[model samples]
Target: MTDKRTTAPALLCDVMIQIKQRLRPLESQEVLWDQAAGRVLAQAITAPVSLPSFPRAAMDGFAVRSSDLEAASPEQPCQLQVRGVAYPARPWPGTVSVGTAVRIMTGAAIPEGADTVAMLEDSEVSADGQFVSFRRPSPPGRHVIAVGEDVRAGQVVLPAGRVLRPQDVALLVALGLTSCPVVRQPRVMLLVSGSELVPPGVIPKVGEIVDSNTPLLQALIPRDGGQVVEVLRVPDDPVLLRQAFRQALTKDIDVVLVSGGSSTGDEDFCPCVLAEMGELVAQGLAIRPAAPTGFGWLNRAGTLLPVVLLPGNPVACLVAYELLAGRIIRHLAGRSLDLPHCQRTAPLRESWSSPPGRLEWVRVCIEQNQAVPLRQRGASSISSLVAADGFFLVPEEVTLYPAGTIVTVYLFDTLSGQQF
Candidate 1:
């Protein structure tokens, strides 16, 4: 009996909505402050104690009552007796009396009865080390950072669902937090299958191609906040693929990505094996370069696991991941439902063309504020992805966009030598 499982390609927006509705979020876990970088915060953080927590000198200077230096100048300086030195680690010995000053270093606590600071450049010390003369007048509270000025106690330092960056971690450390509650990284498994595929660093024997999808997906998954737990290779046999899928689902796998066997060829048995073992949600998408992509759900160990089938072509695989897998990964990590890349609009230097009824992702490079389409070399060319700055989308309704049309460019990097 012939199988009748082929379904029409689903709209891109509909597929995304379905994914958002079906996938469940992962749980939160405690992580050290250092390990929390790039992880989303599970709870809001309030400052336990104020930064600095004390009034300190902002620079190397002498602390004194401002009224005493009212008549001070370069030609006629005000002289005061030297009291004591105030180092950051050691407090001043006594309060400043009238006509007396204390020598203080930067960040040292200001002493009692001192209302102003006269910088070292504007003050002269006597040879006997007994007196200091101020050449310029200083206002009360000048050069002094008041307590809680940087961060007040009980202030909200970080909000929930924020992705922690290096600066964010530093701020948490400054606020005296040794650890943070962050959403746990999702566990992912990668399965690459093909009979004519060989491992990287090995010379392919004439008709074999080196497995690039494994490394590609490995880097992409972790970069998007999913931890890769296992990567395995299987031959063009349905039994091996089915066994591997079931084994992974029985473990603590949150998602499974299968590459290179999603199409309907004689050896392309991924869709069939997955259909026999689980429920297929999507058979295809109306998307250029990655129409053979598919998604499904498997029940194992009393939990549902999402398995996405990516195209064999390198570029198509990357595109499919960005479209579907990225959303699920971000959701599992408690990140916002938005692409992490910085987006901008640029005019097209040349007109773009695509067949109607499919969403197309056109690789483009930014040159002189113009988006220039990269040379089309089909979906297997990895070099095109490397040379591209980002991609511009062509909606399914339109077939052509004229030159000089401003289009949104979803950047892969900031192009400012920084990753988003």
Candidate 2:
């Protein structure tokens, strides 16, 4: 028999911990290094060979032995014969014996006997290219980079579980890696339920609303490393919703996101359907504007698959996704448990009030070091989310705050136009 539940709201922090403990990471896969950006590293990466591999010049200067010019003065320039010119990545092919110097460019290998380099401004090359004079003396090892200076072979470069950034991919390529091992992206199946909902690009008739949740979840799921494999729309009928859940259980899906129909109203069938198919882990959360958020698990072929029921309101759905569904998606992608966001601290432009029972998240915009609260037209307002730069959380312990209150704003635009 499936375990069913309808109980008191769960504390925000406890539910976060529970979600972390319940999920397991997916298997790793091999992908090309160029395609590994935004993916989690499955194994620690080590340098295959030391960078530079040999000693080279770091500046466009004449290679010389320091002792030859130690006693030489600017007025009495140290005169030396220029044996040969060394271009980048090429050596002079001969040693700089006493009173001799090699004209070298940046990144050129040092001659066998040269121990230092003098800048071009300090040396005057003769028109014949056979002689050069130094006005300044250079110490040994100046402007010279030794072998293994940047990275050493067999040394760990990046640890496992690191989210690959653009620079990380460049580093891996520089280390001669053509491919990388990363955790597989989780596949999601989205099911939207509502009798009044219509797809985008279609004008809704009277008493009907455009289906925003489907497109919203489609854009967000992949940003967090989960790919939406399918999207299906179902009416408010329990029979159709039950059939959708049964069909989803038979397919290969990492998680099922059921949007709408999670409330206690008569049309809400997500909780009842989840209870019949599997175990309802929790019914609600003690959070403002998102109290209808819930999650559960369904068993198929002896494997437990997670099912997340989301509220219909766009803003509430966004909050529920970030705090709950996003966590599981990141875990399945082998990412770190910490939720990442670009944070900015600012003072409130006006006073704000909240209830004491549930945690609250307020959308706000930053203007000249102040967080101006956006006008909330209920949780269904998509314009408010777009106009706001980020949001601030209000704990259940605090109810009111005066103007100029400093708060940290968690930015949602960190990964805009880029894969996370």
Candidate 3:
């Protein structure tokens, strides 16, 4: 398991160079308050004013200054004249000369002269409105709020490259900010090439099947944080494919994905077309079911737009995209490397065989804690992938397994919510 292989479609130079090169950063723009949730912040966000502006009451109890309640104890008593309840920004009754108290409601501003106001539960009131007694002594600075405690004015609350969460939106609103800056979504262009492929609704004359890759790809593009600006399909000809690539680059696409015509067959003109677009770093890999995967770039107009030529098989194409092309897309979108790939350890139900010097990913279903290998591992058929929850890798160095051995499974579907 510790051994490694350097079987990429391109040279190490191209791969490393492209990863180091920083593509165009997303645009900076403002969005409405309600719509700013889950967007990246393009600029540093600072607080215009201190949070709470004033020492607002966090509870419904009375507001107090620390000095007045220094010696209040349970055994001793204190009394003050009953002042009426105070409202927000209202005038105080007057200064406290000696042994005087004010009745304050929750969130009311403290009077100018009053140093502290004790809670009603802590003191007993007299019918004469002049006596109050505390059974227990109270502490100073207790139950008091200070200004600028939560956040200070001009303080940077959120930094740039910060992706705003739902709570972030609320915090920005609390700071009196109306809009926020965010990056622009990445744009993608798709090209599907093959003469044997026909549209689904078209009645084929002979030797033709409906093209399923177009609809499948169109549906998956937007979910990966890239917008599908356009999806084009053309017959199996180099002229058409080359023309499509040039036309797509003119429209300013961040990445271009061309499906089919990537194999080693004579009709496979995608590699030639790819060489013309950008220099081919590598043309083949050591992986099974996708050995013919090609990598290149469109270096026209100083835009080194990476092009991923996926195999024609639907399952192979998708899995390859998820494993390889998915990484490039994440790089473009400024996302982390940790994709939602699931991992699990399941018992092998039975033994299996694979070709030598090749890594095989076998689809399996978890049935009663056993990894049941699907009967058919077809490269072209997409139906086999529908019921699979994960795949167990048969390493090139490994070709045999006992029934009960523990094998790590790279899950396709989530193995969540299990009682075990």
Question: Which is the leading candidate under lDDT?
Answer: 1
Q: Which 10 successive residues of model 2 have the least lDDT summed?
A: 1-10
TM-score of each: 0.93, 0.91, 0.75
Ranking according to TM-score, highest score first: 1, 2, 3
| Residues forming the 10-long window of minimal summed lDDT in candidate 3 | 1-10
lDDT of 1 by residue, 142-247 (tens): 9999889999999998999998999999999998899999888999988888998898999999999999988888888877889999888999998899898878
Give a tens-digit lDDT track for model 3, residues 374-410: 8777778788877877777777677677788788877
Tell me the TM-score of model 1.
0.93
> How well is each residue in 80-181 modelled by candidate 2, as lDDT tens digits?
998888987567788899999988899999888999988898888889888888887899999999888989999999899988999999989988999999
Model 2 residue 224 CA deviation in Å? 1.8
- Sum up the clashes in candidate 1: 0
Of candidates 3 and 1, the better by TM-score: 1
Off by over 4 Å in 3: 1-35, 41-49, 73-138, 144-162, 196-211, 342-376, 390-420
lDDT for 384 in candidate 2 is 92
